[model samples]
Target: MEVEKMLHMKGGNEDTSYSKNSLLQRKVISMTECIIKEAITDIYCATNCPKTIVMADLGCSSGPNTLLVSNAFINIINEISLKMGHESLEIQIYLNDLPGNDFNTIFLSLPKFVKNLRKDLCMSNPSPPSCYFNGLPGSFYKRLFPSKSIHFVHSSYSLMWLSQVPHIQETNKGNIYMSTTSPPSVIKAYHQQFKSDFSMFLKCRANEIVSGGRMVLTILGRRNEDPCSKECCYIWELLAMALNDMVIEGLIEEKKMDSFNIPQYTPCSKEVKDEVEKEGSFTINCLEVSEVNWDANTDNRLNLPDKNGGYNVAKCMRAVAEPLLASHFGESIIEEVFIRYRKIITERMSKEKTQFINVTVSMTRKA
Candidate 1:
């Protein structure tokens, strides 16, 4: 489905924009805060204290969370510098995302971020470390920086998206992603895609990151080794059910549904570790999986009397998937589709809650 051109989150600050519906992603970031801190500390300890530190956040989609991790690293580095009596350190921070991402939102919000950063640093040190910020637009699957330029790299809730659909499966007629009903051929295609993409990712980073550089990645993944495990694919399964209902109602054509497939894959922990080991450039320092409820970020206490659990979930999904679906099915059917989606999720939640398995890994570039 030309993922590089169409797989971005909804842009702008509207109701369905990723900026408004990324609470779940923010929660994932919060959950991984300790890992991030530890990675930064390890970087400080392993590398010679260079006067300038360079860092990049891959897939820094537009939202509060875009800078959340970067801000944390800056603060941590500042504290470390002050304690080590190196207050003059400078930091260059790069925020990266796909070309189709809403970079303007992040650009507009940068002044305030810089202001707050300066204010926070001034509270302790009279002369705060200088931080330079730049926005890089491109795919991380390829090279994005000069060799040995980056000291740290971070990505969250991304990397699950493949560069493109692995292969078209006419046999998997009713599904848009991997599901229990999908054929073994479909599963094999997805695994091969991830293996190639992840290997390229590590190779590119190996050239860009300095020796002893660290990277911490947190992505939606599966705990079970099976690629079609329910925990990894149920969200798409419910989404497919919603689309099938639309097809029956004559709102969407069956042929169009047959052609659409989500360009995403959730790998198991073993798969991630295997790729890292095979890439021959990075050592896996730590790998852990955490579980989060599907509705972990939904704020039920909000005074919105009309919002139901299903509706909230629908909003979150719409914020991320609307662009991709609209590209395929046309925009006219989005609202109706999500209405049905909300109903499906609501009924399902009435019986049981669903959860996402999150994989967090820390690695260091080999000397």
Candidate 2:
């Protein structure tokens, strides 16, 4: 454990994973939240807000993903309102995330989206539901919504990352990842952190989810006995190796690298079970964890250094690998890194389609 700490102290990139709401993202997240829609359909029938109701998408990143969320909510609301014979009551939606999120980008795109959507509904000869959209900012782990004030909440992909890093220099004595070199200790520290963070999330959420409110969460996860192995995804391990080789070449020092960490969040099932079971305020409606196939079309574009691809693969991960690369690679080297990253990831995928897993939990608040 101590040896690992010294190596991390030498400097390296701590994180370099990209998150774009891709086709794969849609399949995984939507599947995860499908159950939440079922519960919310009933709730929406009971109270069309203005009479009493609202919904929120926590950590809603700026992009088509936001639209995906909104559309899903719309379908649920439409169905419920139609059933209750109260289609005129406007449903207000709050798109929320940390203030650092690109919410402006999301909002900027929304007006056109609404117009287009209205046009579509008109063509179908259906009365379009009325609604209002607003952006709210806050760390969901802290205070997200007012006390007992939300009817439904949805957050995807974002819950797996903590609001900030949670490791100490001393006890963080292992593989730039684990708190200790021993597999058990590393897993323990990770579980401990997950237990704390998730419980905090539940407590805050408890305040927001009215007596019978609902929530849907989708998180990155893994399967297999060696789920924690560095090689779970060759692309990630290769990136680390590429950066590690640079360290040996005297390109970057180690201390600058270890300074960053992958903000801790529950990585697997055990920790999630611990927190949710302990909270007892939510009833799990669905818990499905499986690997999603990752076969992005890198055929002709394998070695191509695309900018968005670079951002997706690593630039977003600058915080994780800041110690490893910043001193040596130019900020502009994002392209070069993409060149190498693309080559390796494509090779791995072509060899055998790589798969990444997600753990989804759809729960309803206890009344």
Candidate 3:
């Protein structure tokens, strides 16, 4: 499948859009604030306190989280300026995503976003940096900036997506991602694909990032080496179960289910470290894992699908995965699939606690 064209979060500021359902992503971003601050501090010192700092946030999907990275930089840099008794710096930010991403929504929100950002900065520092925003639409797997230009880079909840689905020799029946039932070859294929894509990402960024520049990335990941571990793959497994039920009920074709697979991977920490070492362009600074509840950002945690918790989880997943499903399975079953998914999540969460394992890695460009 053409993932670049088909892979995008549900757009706009609607009830089910990514803008409304991205609190989980916001939480993930917040979790990395310290790492981001450290990286920025190091970059500032290493680059001799650059006056013009160019940064990019890859896979910057639309919504409030879209500008969160820039805001963090502005605040952190201003703090650094005060500590070092240096003048305010100029900040240039490039917001990047796939061509199909909702850049329009982000652009439309920019006027108010900047005004609020500046107002907040004024309270902290009278002379805040002059920040500029640019929307660049492209795949991060390839070059997106001039060589040795960007001073910092940040991406959250995005690297797990492969450039495209792995080409397996056999059909991964009854599953859309690596699962316990998947054959050994299926897991190997996914690992190889992730290695290739991640290596390319590092290599591309190596060219784009100046020496001493830093990058911080957050990905859906697993603590265990097992590809089929619940931490990483259970959500998709539940989604596949919903699809299988629809197939049995004549709502969707079994053939379609058998043919489809997600172009994503949840790597273990070892996998990430290995890929970075193999790529030979960046040095891993820190790698840590955190867990987020499936039913986060809501108080109705005890209730299942019948209440708000499970329903909210389902909506969040839909906001992120609906476009991929619509492109491959047809948009007709989107609503029904999520309805079943919500119930499954509620039942499972009631019996057992399931959470998304997020792997956050901070790295510096090799000199």
Candidate 4:
């Protein structure tokens, strides 16, 4: 299959499956899984269309969580396939990400996952999900899938980040993304990037998604009407503080700071809904707001033992924030920064365990 070659290319990686507890990751798969089942079943029931279904998961990173999502998708597709009496229907699944994702983990885990799925299929009383899986490697901003080849497209937390780092020119010696801190220009720039990337995704998928393909996008976003709310993301706040501390210490010059933009942007759901509706390429099926308490909780099991101590406040943030903090703040500072962040998250969660989590927006292409 050419998709296999696609996986081995410069920006290739094995498909990372995600688990339900992964908050944003699991939710993205869940949203996609729902829409795919609905789209396939509806088309088959109404028009008795051919059952060749192509599905793609964007920004699937390496880990057990990736496989978990894959398994759920396969199950759903297989159930739909059986109901439609299309045992031989093609369910081509694609795992897409940037060039440097951890493909080794995906490659190593696939055999075991497939074997387990087959075993479960044989033993289960119910029919299995009908689908074939492939790892399609590349930036989602570019054309990865063939024209009109995809039936469903899924991405989580990924779309919030730009395909490449946004160029930030130092104006008046301030970081572009951070200096504004939810200023009109900052939000506008982020919204623009999202519109561009998402619009491109629709254009590429328009040809591939048959007449009624579905796309589900889940991302970290703000609940407050104001994008600049401090509570929106304590992670960003902690980083800002860390950077400020650095500046105070004379570790890095203020003039060179703008280059350190967090290659990511989290726009509000309302902003996203307006943009998709305005694009007119697709119809909005639903926009859901869920809490994403990535911060730690107070479950002091023997193993976890409140691992971060009172830092449970910073619960689930360690995954994404760790890399950036490590990179800019230095390996030595990550532990310190996280310690402080956790202290804040722990206290914050005590009052409210979950901040409005990621929002999953589902849309179907217009015929």
Candidate 5:
């Protein structure tokens, strides 16, 4: 599958759109806000107070979270400026995602975001700085901005996606991602892919980010070194099982399933640190790993006393994975497949508590 073209969140304001089902991502962002603040503070302290600040949020998918994060940064910068006695700072904010993301929704919401931003700043003793927001659509695996132009870079729950599937994974049949049953070769392939992609990511950012600038990244990752750990990839394993059931029911072809692989990997902290050292462009300031329940953002309505948690999980998965799954398995079976997936996850949840391990890292460009 062409991952760049196929990998996008469900668009529009429909029930399955990413805007509706992105509560988990929102929770992740909220959890990492303090880390983000620290990174921005580091940048402010290390550099002279400049008249302009350029910042970018990579893989900023559409929805409330996009502007939500931007506003957070603006607030932080304003607060620091007030303490520092700086009069006016111009802020340039860049929102980046794949070319296929829903930029329209974000664009439409900007006026309201700015209006609220102005209102909030007026309520403060010192007025907030003027800010400009623009959408830059492309892959962050390559250059997305001019050299040394960005002051702060932030990415949440996005770096786990590999630039593309590993070439050696054709042998990884019956599985869409790394699992306990995957051979050593498949695991090695995933690790190598992450190393290559992350190295490039650091290289690109190293050029775009100014000296002393900081980057804060929050990604889905594993606690242990093993790539096949359940906490890292059990969700994909369950998804593969759902597809297998569809194949048995003559709903999807087995060959299609065999050929499809998710272009994502959850790297361990050691792996991430190793790549940063190898790339030789950034100094790691902090690295932390935290776990959140699989249904971290399930609403009360969905979390009724008797409701199955898998239903909410399935909905979240569909919002993000539907585009790719529909491309391969056909749109007709998207609903049926998720139905089966819900049952599988529900059964598993009843037996055990599944959680996703998130890794948050803070770094600064080498001087």
Candidate 6:
């Protein structure tokens, strides 16, 4: 599959769009709020309160959460400048993602976003930083900015996606991701792909970020060393089961199921640290793992399988995966596939509680 052309969250603001269904991602962002502030704060301290700050949000998919982190950065820097009596600070942020991303939606929302930002800042300081926003469209696994140009970097829920699917000799039959049934070679192939992609990411960013700059990355990761751990791979497992059932019912072809594999890998925390060390461009400031419930929201209802919780989880998964699935399996089966997936999710949720493991890491570009 051509991952760069196909890999994007559902776009626009419709019911099925990523903009509406990205609450879980929003929650993850909220979880990392303090770290982002600290990273930005550290940048200010290390750089002796520079007059201009340049930052980029890598893989910044369009949605409510797309600008949430940027807003925080502006707010934090503004407050710090006020405290230090530094009145003339400038912030330049580049919002980046793949070319297929919904940059229009984000661009259209900026007027209201800036209006609210200025209104909020009016209370404390008469003037805010001269902030500028630009949309950068491309892959981040390669260089996207001029050397030593960026002062701070942030990426949320993106590094888990590999640049391309792992090339494996084994077929990984009946599974769309790493699974218990997958051969050991398939597991090794996925891990190697992640290592290569992440190393390239570090190398690219190392060139762009100035010495002593800070970066914070939030990734969907696993607690267990095993690649097929439930937290990381069960979501895809259930979807594969739904597809296999469709094939049996003659709704889709069996070969499509056998040939498909998600171009993503959820690494353990150790894997992340090892890659950072191997790349040798940044020093790890802090790395921690946190767990978020599969239905990371508050919808007080009966806890029955096939109920509200499962429906929400299904919608969230669809928001992120529907585009990729449609590109390969055909769009006609998408609605049906998720319908079945919702049922499976509810059934599984009823039996045992499951959570997504998130790895939040802060790093500094070594001087």
Q: Between the candidate structures 4 and 5, which one is better when assessed by lDDT?
A: 5
Among all candidates shown, the one with the greatest TM-score: 6
Q: Write the per-residue lDDT of candidate 1 for residues 1-367, one digit (tens) a residue.
A: 7888898889898887888888888888998888899999889878988889999999999988899988999999988888888868999999999999999999999999999999999998776789999999999999999999999999999999898898755557899998888888888898899999999999999999999999999879999998999999998999999999889899999999988888889998999999999889999999999976677544434522223667767888898899999999999999998988988988887776577899999999999
Which regions of candidate 6 fall more than 4 Å away from where they truly are? 298-307
**Candidates ranked, most accurate by lDDT first:** 6, 3, 1, 5, 2, 4
Which pairs of residues collide in model 1? none
What lDDT does each candidate get? 0.89, 0.60, 0.90, 0.58, 0.87, 0.91
Judged by whole-model lDDT over C-alpha atoms, candidate 2 comes out at 0.60
Worst 10 residues of 4 by lDDT: 1-10
RMSD of each: 2.4, 6.8, 2.0, 6.0, 2.2, 1.9
Tell me the tens digit of each residue's lDDT in model 4 across 203-244: 676666656777777877776656555445555665565555
lDDT score of model 3? 0.90
Per-candidate TM-scores read: 0.96, 0.78, 0.96, 0.78, 0.96, 0.97
- Which lDDT tens digits does candidate 2 get at residues 97-205? 7665566677788889888866764553366577678898767778766788888888777676655455443433213454324246545555566667788999899
lDDT of 3 by residue, 165-281 (tens): 998888898999999999888998998999999999999999999998999999999999888898889999999999999999999998899889999999989899999998889
Give the per-residue lDDT digits (tens) of candidate 5, residues 1-367: 7777877788888888889888788888988888899988778778897899989999999986887678888998888998888877899999999888999999999998899888888787365799999999999999999999999999999999988988874467789999888778888898889999999999999999999999999989989887899888899999999999888888898888888889998988988899999999999999999877788654434443225478778888998899998888789999888889999999998878677889989999999
Backbone clash pairs for candidate 5 read none
Best by lDDT: 6
